[model samples]
Every structure is written in C-alpha cells, then in structure tokens.
Target: MTHAPMADPPTTPAQTAARVLLGSAMVLAGTSHLTVARDDFQAQVPVWLPLNKDFVVLASGVVEIGLGAALLALPRERRTVGWVLAAFYVAIFPGNISQYLSHQSAFGLDTDQKRLVRLFFQPVLVLWALWSTGAWPRRRG
Candidate 1:
C-alpha cells in the first residue's frame, strides 16, 4: 500500500499571509467574545437555541481561541482547520439571521440595511478560511 505523504502541500506566500491574518483576527474576535464584546455577542444568540446565551457565547469564545491558535500553529493541519472554521462560520449563521429577524441590534449592525449587508460577509469568511488554508485547493491537473 502506498502511504500518502505526511506533510500538507506548501502554501504560497500570499496564502500564508492570509492565513496568519485570519488566525490573528479569530484570536482577537474570540478574545472580544470573552471580554468587551461578551454581551454584544450574547445579544446575537437566538432565543430558540435552548442553551444559556452567556454559556454559548463563552464556549464559542474558547473554541474560537483554540481554533485560531491551532490555525496559526499547525501548518500540517491547516486544511483540516480551514474546513472546521468554515463549518463554524456556517454553524453560527443563524445568529446573524436571528439578529436581523429579531431586530436585536449589536456590533454596530443596528440598522436593517446594515444587518442585511453583514449577512453577506459570513460567506466571505468561509471562503477566506478555505482558500487561505488550502482547504479549497486549486485544481492540480
């Protein structure tokens, strides 16, 4: 049986830059979830989720911190982390939708138009994660 190479393919300088930027951003955002923006993040939690909003916020904060650190520190696992982070973005989408639908204002998305526009950025984050970490690798023909 042929064993696959142990290492992930090398990323380009641009990809490395983007990954680092995203990793740093995640760490900062996670920090905010546990600190200054805790309440704001909680405000975005959907009431229907059943879990306590504060617990959800704090738990996600910890998760983000871990994922961000891993992304920064684990090049060999970058693709895995990228997929997971993209999934995380997808998983939390309802919070953004709830903020819009429930008319709960937080994180400067106080207006209907602003909230609507903000929804578009989540997909961009997903793409950024995938592309930066080579999860969505280019065709290798």
Candidate 2:
C-alpha cells in the first residue's frame, strides 16, 4: 500500500504573533488572579461548587502562569503545552458560564450581551492555543 505524504509543519508570522500575544495575556491574567483582581475573579466561581472560591482562583492563577511560561519559553514542548492549555480553557469554561448566568459583572463584561459574547470567545481561545502552537496539524493521520 502507498503511504500518504506527510508535509512539514508550518508556522506563519501571524501564528507567531498570536502565540506571543496569547502567552502574554495568560501571564497577565494569571498575575491578576493572584494580585489586584483576586476579588473580582471570585465572582466567576460557581455557587454550586463546594470548594473555596479563593483557593480555586489561586490554583488556577498558578496554572495559568505556568502554562503561559511554557508557551513562551518551551518551544520544543509547544504542542504539548497547547494541548494542556486547551484543556485548561475547557476546564475554566464553567466560570464563564457562571459569570453569564449570575450576572456577575467583572472585567469589562458589564452586561448580559457582553457576558454572552465573552462565552463564545472561550472556544476561540482554545483554538488559538492549539493553532498557535502547531498542535492541530500534528494530530493528522
């Protein structure tokens, strides 16, 4: 049987820019999670969850910083980092939903429409994390 050809993985300037921007955003967001915006982040914690909101925020913040640094500093591990970061995005989606449902205004998401639209961006972020780090094409047969 003939084998299908495998093409080299590609990286574009746009992808590089996206990776840098997304990585920096994650670092900044993680910093906020630990520092000035800690209280604001608490608004997104679901009331149904039994865990302490502060602890959740702190833990997630630490995760964000680690993932961000990996994306930036670990070129060889970018694909793995991309996968982990995508899962992290998925894991935190509940917080976005919680924000929308509870009408908890934080950041610039001051209204229902804003919060709803912000919810849609989570998937985009997930995709960005994968695409920017070359994780998508690597999964092909």
Query: Candidate 2 on 27-117: residue-level lDDT in tens?
Result: 9999999999998899899888899999999999999999998888876677788899999999999999999999999988899999999
Which stretches in model 2 have alpha-carbon errors above 4 Å?
1-10, 138-141
User: Model 2 — TM-score against the truth?
Assistant: 0.88
User: TM-scores, in order shown?
Assistant: 0.95, 0.88
In model 1, the runs with Cα more than 4 Å from the true position are 1-5
In model 1, which range of ten residues has the least summed lDDT? 3-12
All models, RMSD in angstroms:
1.9, 5.2
**Would you give me the overall lDDT of model 1?**
0.93
Backbone N/Cα/C clashes per model: 0, 0
Give the clashing pairs for model 1.
none
